[model samples]
Target: MKVGLVWFGDDLRSADQNILWRAMQEVDFLVCLYCMEPHHQRPSRYATQGMSENRRRFLQQGLNGLNATLAKVGQTLFVSSMDADTSLNLILNEVPISHLYRNHHGGWDEQQTLKRIENQYPDVRIQIDHGLSLFTPSQLPFNLTGLPESFSKFRRLVENVDSTTPLPSLHKLPPAPSFNIHNIMPWQHQITDNHSAFTGGEEAAMDQLSDYFSTNLPNQYKAMRNELDGWENSTKLSPWLAQGSLSARQIKASLDVYERDHGASESTYWIYFELLWREYFHWYATRYGKQLFLPGGLTGKQTQGSYYAERFRKWSQGNTPYPIVNACMKQLNETGFMSNRGRQIVASCLIYELGIDWRYGAAYFEEQLIDYNVGSNWGNWQYIAGVGADPRGGRHFNLEKQTAQYDPNQNFTHKWQGQVYDSQLDSVDAADWPIYPTSSN
Candidate 1:
């Protein structure tokens, strides 16, 4: 029996899919899989261990939604309790898999995993499609190594380059192996409904796109995107985008519709512009590889600050002196979501005001955010700390100034209980007796 394996990672959706399409054309039977790695359930070296509860719940929803889609085409998602490497070994051992297929992921570790699979199973035909980003590697103006050093430079080169149209939705797929099909639990679309504040699947993502564009919300995105809090102010699609349940082109496709229905405006253009920013980081992470997580980042120039536990805890829990930062932190803790503006305010506070290592802030975000993407999360922290792509050294927002501007009425702060506390920024003074903060990853 010729069997192909579709290993689902960050890319969970079935619509506009490339890997599944090609797999369907060749394989007599296919098995879909998603592996929940051990470390993802444990804590990391920073404030967070693994994925946050909110993040896990959202991921589960994404899986359910994807499984529902696959079920429609006579397939099911086999979620294993092991990590990717272990799961692949076990599956390939049980069945002589003819091929392996997946979408390209930017994380260095994710790429390495696939590379190892290719080397270990040379006979297994490996196919990876670059469907996650708006543009594929061949579509880029320059080679991956020659990617622009800054977002502005990258923007200037690609802004005129149009995004490709998303492939049409899939109506059929290869059947799962008869022996493997019965054991898996099935999910129907009815099992998932819009009950919580946000839903995780591709179905929910498409609905959000349709509903947002059906009204005048896209027209106001640019002006309201900076607000401290408001649903209509922004697209609120990051969580879905981060999970890969909603492809960037899927969102751009909606923008195309909205533009056709109602003429394009600056707000509409800004929507695509933000997508370009995301596309830039996807390439950035791929280009920098291990350096994407380094203290000096891509530049090899180290900056100030190390890990101070007490200070890190206070900053993450929303107990710092800055009310705006406190409010943002608290909002993140309560919900897996945060405004983009809030992320900037809290990240600045962690690096500049509190004197904590920027990686701690990045790691904490990786733990808590429902929308966390390895490239966007780490790349962004590096950007704010002046260790990444920012043309300016880094951003140091005046908390007082930011507070007056975004929370003039203090409504957001009050709702999140962002009360000020008087205390020194440093947990330990330069006593010859006190130990230095540990800065290792």
Candidate 2:
């Protein structure tokens, strides 16, 4: 009897889940697991949390939703507060698992966990299926080593590639192996926290998908996508996409249906275009691996900034000299989200104006963003810092120009209290001596 154990990472929903569907075919009994690793809750060298209170609660909501989704089909999600390696060890010892299954993820730490599992349990037949990405690596037009260096080049090359289809929902799953999992709770156990503008879970993901396409919203997405505030300005499906409640392929499939039904426009096509950018970063993270986190990134070019305690603190707290940057930061802190344009503007301010390390900004986003993905976050940061995939070097947005263009009416700025009267950036100089505050002219 082949008893299977599947470790679920960001991909939580059981519907359109490749691993869950496959496990039932290959194993007589199965265990579905998700570990809420402690590392995510701790602080890193930058002094920000690996995960913030908002992020943690958002993730818990995903787990709770995934758990409930699985329960409807007679399966359960076994969650753990312990680290993944220990939990997998404890389960393998008791389950006699002959097979292991999981959705593929591009995170370095997640890769390390898979390696540990492989070495410890050579006898288990581990199978990884793709649902996280729109296209599997094999489906890519080129080898992973030959992935395009620029999003433009990448987009041009893959313009004709076929879209991927989402797997059908699993109506029923294999029974559990009946082995006791240590430090576990019933599937109904839930930890609720301050919910965000977006709910976390697959059901909500599908609901949002339906609601968005059910309207003329897709036609308007391109024009308003860059807006700083309006909720309907963008697809707003990212939080769910990041949590694996919604797959990239699922979104692509929906886009196809929407285009066919509503008629394709540039806005409809731009939706596809944005997804390709996401697809590029997913491959970018996969190809670069640990380099994605490095300062030099894929290019190995030296970055301009270093860590500055006070400037970083003020920038993060939305008390920066630049009101637009401050507004963007305030929006991020309060809502656990930021518009794409807002991210780039504030990222440029951190790297160029404040002269704080780009990694610090990326780490802060990792902590705060309800929609954080390892690849896109770091890759875009590297691009902003002029160290990553930008063939033309880094981007430095004109804060004044950006403020005039995006927040001309100052509606967004006023709403978020962007006009901070911070004449002095730091209270102390390098020598820890008192520095006179300057007047803002």
Candidate 3:
């Protein structure tokens, strides 16, 4: 019997999972696997302790759901903390692996890893399918090479294109192919910190979608999305989407149905527009690649002066005296999330307000956020830092002004300002504003 091996990464769900779907079609027996990179526990550019405990716990929960789904369909989900290259080699030597399948993530590190694997195991047939975006790059009207330099142009061309790619359905697993294999790693079971309030798995993602589209909250999304004080204000699907627990297409489809069955309005389209923005970032990263990670970023301009790790820490911890900025940072530290408006404001403060390098801030977010996607995080950092597509150089948010607009009554700021949320927040105490060298600074 032909054997198929799937090395799952960010694409965690069973539904609409092209990698799993294609694997089932190609081979009679399949081995589903997940490899947790060993380096995940080390200090990253942002979090010194690696991925925060809360994010990992949430991810573990999602992995459990994925495993259960596979089990229901007669498949076993094997997991490891091994490096991709080493693990793929082991699979090749141990199993009758005819093909290796996975999703194509745009990050340079992930691409590099794939290249190394193909080089090491040249005989295996490797397939990369689109499982992340609602519409894959290949499925888009324009190629990455010809993708518009500006988001608006890209948005215009693809706005009306059919995003009808159906989410792949799960199927029963054939008997396991004969192989000399080690026992599957047990799930890293841990209770997620209640502070974060985000759950994992395809089930949780779909449940959240159902709740969002439910009549009680559907119409209020537009007005509530910006409110920072309560979970009721936002869809909160971002963590799931960021971690691959949810697919963008699924969210878009649900929204579309809500519009048709319920009624379309400015709020309905606004959510779709936000999804487009997410698409723009993905395409932007695919087009730009490593440039997105550098200090100057996509514009090719070198950042001025030296970077201070101390100052970067302050911003990450949210201790900077600006209560509004600190409050948003605190929320992120405690819950692994912040509202969209909160994200923009804090990111701007790190760049324009703190005068630190944008990469420092971007890296910090990547390490902490449950929804951290390379494209969106870095793409947004470069945009806010004035290094990416924004012709205006940078998008700066005035903290006091932002506080007035988003947290007008200071309720959002006050919610997390003191006692409970300061463990990490105190690291970046904003006791006094840094002196700017120039008026712009």
> How high is the CA lDDT of each candidate model?
0.86, 0.86, 0.77
TM-score of each: 0.93, 0.95, 0.90
The best candidate by TM-score is: 2
TM-score of 2: 0.95
Off by over 4 Å in 2: 191-195, 429-441
Model 3 whole-model lDDT (C-alpha atoms): 0.77
Q: Name the TM-score of candidate 1.
A: 0.93
Error of 1 at 126 (Å): 0.8
- Write the candidate numbers in order of decreasing TM-score: 2, 1, 3
Q: List the residue pairs that clash in candidate 2.
A: 386-394
Candidate 1's residue-wise lDDT over 1-441, tens digit each?
Answer: 679999998888998788998988889899898887888899787757788878878988998889888888888888877778878887887777998999999999888888888889999999989888999888889999999999999999998887778877678888877544222333433344344578898988888878888899899999999898878879989999988888998998899989998999999999999999999999999998999888889878978979877678778888878878888988888788899999999999999988888999999999999999988999999999999999897899999999999999999998898876547545456674444456522
Ranking by lDDT: 2, 1, 3
Residue 139 in candidate 1 has what lDDT?
82
Q: Which whole-number lDDT from 0 to 100 does residue 286 have in model 1?
A: 91
Model 2 clashing-pair count: 1
Clashing residue pairs in candidate 3 are 16-168, 196-335, 314-428, 319-428, 319-429, 319-430, 320-430, 321-430, 386-393
Weakest ten-residue segment in model 1 by summed lDDT: 181-190
Question: Model 2, 159-193: lDDT tens per residue?
Answer: 67896667888888887766666686555555675
Question: Residue 270's C-alpha lDDT in candidate 2?
Answer: 96
Count steric clashes of candidate 3: 9
For model 3, the superposed segments whose C-alpha errors exceed 4 Å read: 45-47, 178-195, 418-441
